[model samples]
Target: MTMTNTAPAPTVWATLQANDAPALIDFLVNTFGFIKTAAYADGDQVAHAQLDWPEGGGIMLGSYKPDQEWSRRPGTAGMYVVTADPDALYAKVRAAGADIFRPITDQDYGNREFGVRDPEGNLWSFGHYRGEPHP
Candidate 1:
Protein backbone atom coordinates (compact mmCIF):
# COMPACT_ATOMS: atom_id res chain seq x y z
CA MET A 1 0.00 0.00 0.00
CA THR A 2 1.10 3.56 -0.67
CA MET A 3 0.87 6.21 2.01
CA THR A 4 0.45 9.90 1.41
CA ASN A 5 0.18 13.19 3.24
CA THR A 6 -1.64 16.45 2.55
CA ALA A 7 0.31 18.67 4.91
CA PRO A 8 0.75 22.27 3.82
CA ALA A 9 4.46 22.22 4.52
CA PRO A 10 7.20 19.77 5.28
CA THR A 11 7.17 18.59 8.88
CA VAL A 12 9.85 15.95 8.70
CA TRP A 13 13.57 16.47 8.41
CA ALA A 14 16.47 14.13 7.77
CA THR A 15 19.25 14.32 10.36
CA LEU A 16 22.80 13.12 10.63
CA GLN A 17 25.91 13.30 12.78
CA ALA A 18 29.18 14.40 11.30
CA ASN A 19 32.71 14.04 12.56
CA ASP A 20 33.43 17.59 11.48
CA ALA A 21 30.09 19.33 11.43
CA PRO A 22 31.33 22.70 10.23
CA ALA A 23 33.29 21.26 7.35
CA LEU A 24 30.40 19.01 6.44
CA ILE A 25 28.07 21.98 6.41
CA ASP A 26 30.47 23.81 4.14
CA PHE A 27 30.73 20.90 1.76
CA LEU A 28 26.97 20.47 1.64
CA VAL A 29 26.36 24.13 1.03
CA ASN A 30 29.07 24.53 -1.59
CA THR A 31 28.91 21.19 -3.33
CA PHE A 32 25.23 20.34 -3.20
CA GLY A 33 23.63 23.78 -3.23
CA PHE A 34 22.17 23.42 0.25
CA ILE A 35 21.60 26.66 2.10
CA LYS A 36 23.22 27.01 5.51
CA THR A 37 20.34 28.22 7.61
CA ALA A 38 21.65 27.86 11.14
CA ALA A 39 24.45 26.32 13.16
CA TYR A 40 25.16 26.24 16.88
CA ALA A 41 28.63 25.30 17.92
CA ASP A 42 30.96 25.09 20.89
CA GLY A 43 34.58 25.43 19.85
CA ASP A 44 35.18 22.73 17.27
CA GLN A 45 32.10 20.68 18.08
CA VAL A 46 28.78 21.68 16.58
CA ALA A 47 25.68 21.38 18.70
CA HIS A 48 23.24 21.67 15.80
CA ALA A 49 22.88 22.82 12.22
CA GLN A 50 20.19 23.24 9.58
CA LEU A 51 20.77 23.10 5.85
CA ASP A 52 17.87 23.80 3.52
CA TRP A 53 17.57 22.49 0.01
CA PRO A 54 16.54 25.22 -2.38
CA GLU A 55 13.84 23.17 -4.03
CA GLY A 56 12.22 22.23 -0.73
CA GLY A 57 12.85 20.62 2.66
CA GLY A 58 16.08 20.53 4.65
CA ILE A 59 18.24 18.58 7.08
CA MET A 60 19.54 18.90 10.61
CA LEU A 61 22.99 17.71 11.61
CA GLY A 62 25.50 18.00 14.39
CA SER A 63 28.84 16.74 15.59
CA TYR A 64 29.28 13.08 16.42
CA LYS A 65 29.04 12.60 20.15
CA PRO A 66 29.37 9.04 21.36
CA ASP A 67 28.53 9.72 24.99
CA GLN A 68 25.28 11.55 24.38
CA GLU A 69 21.98 9.76 24.64
CA TRP A 70 21.05 10.77 21.09
CA SER A 71 24.50 10.16 19.71
CA ARG A 72 24.75 8.77 16.18
CA ARG A 73 27.63 7.24 14.31
CA PRO A 74 29.17 9.37 11.62
CA GLY A 75 29.71 8.30 8.01
CA THR A 76 26.70 6.02 8.07
CA ALA A 77 23.92 8.18 6.70
CA GLY A 78 22.30 7.76 3.31
CA MET A 79 19.93 10.45 2.04
CA TYR A 80 17.96 10.78 -1.16
CA VAL A 81 17.30 14.34 -2.24
CA VAL A 82 14.73 15.43 -4.81
CA THR A 83 15.76 17.95 -7.37
CA ALA A 84 14.23 19.42 -10.48
CA ASP A 85 17.36 19.15 -12.58
CA PRO A 86 19.57 16.21 -11.80
CA ASP A 87 21.70 16.59 -14.89
CA ALA A 88 22.73 20.15 -14.06
CA LEU A 89 23.29 19.36 -10.41
CA TYR A 90 25.29 16.28 -11.37
CA ALA A 91 27.58 18.38 -13.51
CA LYS A 92 28.08 20.86 -10.70
CA VAL A 93 28.75 18.14 -8.15
CA ARG A 94 31.29 16.54 -10.44
CA ALA A 95 32.97 19.87 -11.01
CA ALA A 96 33.41 20.25 -7.27
CA GLY A 97 35.48 17.06 -7.20
CA ALA A 98 32.92 15.12 -5.17
CA ASP A 99 33.27 11.35 -4.98
CA ILE A 100 30.75 9.97 -7.42
CA PHE A 101 29.71 6.42 -6.64
CA ARG A 102 26.99 6.29 -9.28
CA PRO A 103 26.93 8.20 -12.53
CA ILE A 104 23.77 10.06 -13.48
CA THR A 105 21.37 7.95 -15.51
CA ASP A 106 17.72 7.55 -16.39
CA GLN A 107 15.96 5.14 -14.09
CA ASP A 108 13.20 2.80 -15.19
CA TYR A 109 10.99 4.42 -12.56
CA GLY A 110 11.03 7.58 -14.66
CA ASN A 111 13.63 9.53 -12.69
CA ARG A 112 17.07 10.80 -13.57
CA GLU A 113 19.49 10.43 -10.67
CA PHE A 114 23.04 10.11 -9.44
CA GLY A 115 24.86 9.30 -6.22
CA VAL A 116 27.84 10.83 -4.49
CA ARG A 117 29.73 10.70 -1.22
CA ASP A 118 30.43 13.73 0.89
CA PRO A 119 33.74 14.51 2.55
CA GLU A 120 32.33 13.10 5.76
CA GLY A 121 31.57 9.83 3.96
CA ASN A 122 27.82 10.28 3.97
CA LEU A 123 26.04 8.98 0.90
CA TRP A 124 23.76 11.35 -1.03
CA SER A 125 21.55 10.56 -3.96
CA PHE A 126 19.99 13.30 -6.07
CA GLY A 127 17.10 12.75 -8.41
CA HIS A 128 14.16 14.37 -10.14
CA TYR A 129 11.54 12.19 -8.52
CA ARG A 130 8.97 14.10 -6.46
CA GLY A 131 7.19 11.00 -5.29
CA GLU A 132 3.50 10.20 -5.75
CA PRO A 133 0.80 12.81 -5.41
CA HIS A 134 -0.78 13.46 -2.05
CA PRO A 135 -4.20 12.01 -1.52
Candidate 2:
Protein backbone atom coordinates (compact mmCIF):
# COMPACT_ATOMS: atom_id res chain seq x y z
CA MET A 1 0.00 0.00 0.00
CA THR A 2 1.30 3.38 -1.03
CA MET A 3 0.02 6.96 -1.26
CA THR A 4 -0.47 8.78 -4.55
CA ASN A 5 -1.72 12.26 -5.50
CA THR A 6 -3.89 11.32 -8.45
CA ALA A 7 -7.62 10.92 -8.71
CA PRO A 8 -9.95 10.24 -11.60
CA ALA A 9 -13.41 11.74 -12.20
CA PRO A 10 -16.20 9.74 -10.67
CA THR A 11 -18.08 7.31 -12.87
CA VAL A 12 -21.82 7.38 -12.38
CA TRP A 13 -24.57 4.88 -12.92
CA ALA A 14 -27.50 7.09 -13.85
CA THR A 15 -31.00 5.94 -13.09
CA LEU A 16 -34.23 7.49 -14.29
CA GLN A 17 -37.55 7.17 -12.49
CA ALA A 18 -40.69 6.52 -14.45
CA ASN A 19 -44.23 5.30 -13.77
CA ASP A 20 -43.42 1.75 -14.84
CA ALA A 21 -39.73 1.02 -14.74
CA PRO A 22 -40.15 -2.44 -16.21
CA ALA A 23 -41.92 -1.07 -19.26
CA LEU A 24 -39.39 1.70 -19.70
CA ILE A 25 -36.47 -0.68 -19.29
CA ASP A 26 -38.09 -3.01 -21.78
CA PHE A 27 -38.37 -0.24 -24.30
CA LEU A 28 -34.73 0.70 -23.88
CA VAL A 29 -33.58 -2.90 -24.28
CA ASN A 30 -35.99 -4.20 -26.91
CA THR A 31 -36.07 -1.05 -28.97
CA PHE A 32 -32.77 0.75 -28.46
CA GLY A 33 -30.68 -2.38 -27.81
CA PHE A 34 -29.65 -2.09 -24.16
CA ILE A 35 -29.20 -5.37 -22.30
CA LYS A 36 -30.59 -6.05 -18.84
CA THR A 37 -27.79 -6.92 -16.44
CA ALA A 38 -29.60 -6.65 -13.12
CA ALA A 39 -33.09 -5.99 -11.78
CA TYR A 40 -35.19 -6.16 -8.64
CA ALA A 41 -38.90 -5.86 -8.00
CA ASP A 42 -41.08 -4.84 -5.13
CA GLY A 43 -43.43 -7.78 -5.54
CA ASP A 44 -44.21 -8.18 -9.28
CA GLN A 45 -43.42 -4.72 -10.53
CA VAL A 46 -39.86 -3.60 -11.08
CA ALA A 47 -38.53 -1.48 -8.23
CA HIS A 48 -35.02 -1.15 -9.58
CA ALA A 49 -33.35 -2.19 -12.81
CA GLN A 50 -30.04 -1.97 -14.63
CA LEU A 51 -29.21 -1.89 -18.32
CA ASP A 52 -25.79 -2.56 -19.82
CA TRP A 53 -24.57 -0.31 -22.57
CA PRO A 54 -23.43 -1.93 -25.78
CA GLU A 55 -20.37 0.27 -25.81
CA GLY A 56 -19.32 0.91 -22.20
CA GLY A 57 -21.43 2.57 -19.48
CA GLY A 58 -24.70 1.52 -17.86
CA ILE A 59 -28.15 2.86 -16.91
CA MET A 60 -30.63 2.07 -14.17
CA LEU A 61 -34.38 2.26 -14.05
CA GLY A 62 -36.77 2.69 -11.15
CA SER A 63 -40.40 3.55 -10.60
CA TYR A 64 -41.00 7.24 -10.21
CA LYS A 65 -42.26 8.56 -6.92
CA PRO A 66 -44.09 11.87 -6.94
CA ASP A 67 -42.18 12.93 -3.87
CA GLN A 68 -38.76 12.96 -5.55
CA GLU A 69 -37.78 15.98 -7.63
CA TRP A 70 -36.57 13.99 -10.66
CA SER A 71 -39.69 11.86 -10.39
CA ARG A 72 -42.11 14.74 -9.81
CA ARG A 73 -41.20 16.41 -13.10
CA PRO A 74 -40.12 15.18 -16.50
CA GLY A 75 -36.43 15.27 -17.40
CA THR A 76 -35.42 17.71 -20.11
CA ALA A 77 -31.71 17.00 -19.97
CA GLY A 78 -30.03 13.66 -20.54
CA MET A 79 -26.56 12.31 -20.94
CA TYR A 80 -25.68 11.05 -24.43
CA VAL A 81 -24.91 7.43 -25.18
CA VAL A 82 -22.47 6.47 -27.90
CA THR A 83 -23.60 4.26 -30.76
CA ALA A 84 -21.95 2.90 -33.87
CA ASP A 85 -24.89 3.98 -35.95
CA PRO A 86 -26.49 7.09 -34.55
CA ASP A 87 -28.91 7.53 -37.45
CA ALA A 88 -30.28 4.04 -37.24
CA LEU A 89 -30.59 4.13 -33.45
CA TYR A 90 -32.39 7.48 -33.65
CA ALA A 91 -34.94 6.01 -36.03
CA LYS A 92 -35.38 3.02 -33.77
CA VAL A 93 -35.86 5.14 -30.68
CA ARG A 94 -38.44 7.26 -32.53
CA ALA A 95 -40.37 4.20 -33.58
CA ALA A 96 -40.38 2.94 -30.03
CA GLY A 97 -41.79 6.20 -28.50
CA ALA A 98 -39.14 8.90 -28.45
CA ASP A 99 -40.06 12.36 -29.69
CA ILE A 100 -37.38 13.74 -31.98
CA PHE A 101 -36.11 16.99 -30.55
CA ARG A 102 -33.40 17.45 -33.17
CA PRO A 103 -32.98 15.41 -36.28
CA ILE A 104 -29.73 13.52 -36.72
CA THR A 105 -27.18 15.60 -38.52
CA ASP A 106 -23.44 16.06 -38.62
CA GLN A 107 -22.14 18.97 -36.62
CA ASP A 108 -19.63 21.43 -38.00
CA TYR A 109 -17.45 20.78 -35.01
CA GLY A 110 -17.55 16.98 -34.93
CA ASN A 111 -19.88 13.99 -34.61
CA ARG A 112 -23.36 13.31 -35.94
CA GLU A 113 -25.95 13.37 -33.17
CA PHE A 114 -29.64 13.75 -32.34
CA GLY A 115 -31.86 14.65 -29.41
CA VAL A 116 -35.04 12.96 -28.27
CA ARG A 117 -37.54 12.96 -25.42
CA ASP A 118 -38.81 9.73 -23.92
CA PRO A 119 -42.44 8.89 -23.06
CA GLU A 120 -41.96 10.03 -19.48
CA GLY A 121 -40.24 13.18 -20.74
CA ASN A 122 -36.66 12.15 -20.06
CA LEU A 123 -34.37 13.50 -22.72
CA TRP A 124 -32.45 10.78 -24.59
CA SER A 125 -29.58 11.27 -27.00
CA PHE A 126 -27.67 8.91 -29.30
CA GLY A 127 -24.49 9.87 -31.06
CA HIS A 128 -21.04 8.79 -32.21
CA TYR A 129 -17.67 10.46 -32.52
CA ARG A 130 -16.53 11.97 -35.77
CA GLY A 131 -13.99 13.86 -33.73
CA GLU A 132 -14.87 14.79 -30.17
CA PRO A 133 -17.85 15.59 -27.94
CA HIS A 134 -17.72 18.54 -25.62
CA PRO A 135 -17.65 17.74 -21.93
Best by TM-score: 1
lDDT of 1 by residue, 16-122 (tens): 99889999999999999999989999988999999989888999999999999998799988999999999999999999999999999999999999999998888
lDDT per residue as tens, model 2, 28-114 = 788779989898988546767889886767787777677756564435438688888898887877777667888898988677999
* Candidate 1 wrongly placed segments (more than 4 Å): 1-7
List pairs with backbone clashes in candidate 2. Answer: none
Best by lDDT: 1
Error of 1 at 47 (Å): 0.3
Candidate 2, residue 92: Cα displacement in angstroms equals 2.7
For each candidate in the order shown, give its overall lDDT on alpha carbons.
Answer: 0.93, 0.75
Question: Least lDDT summed over 10 consecutive residues: which range in candidate 2?
Answer: 68-77
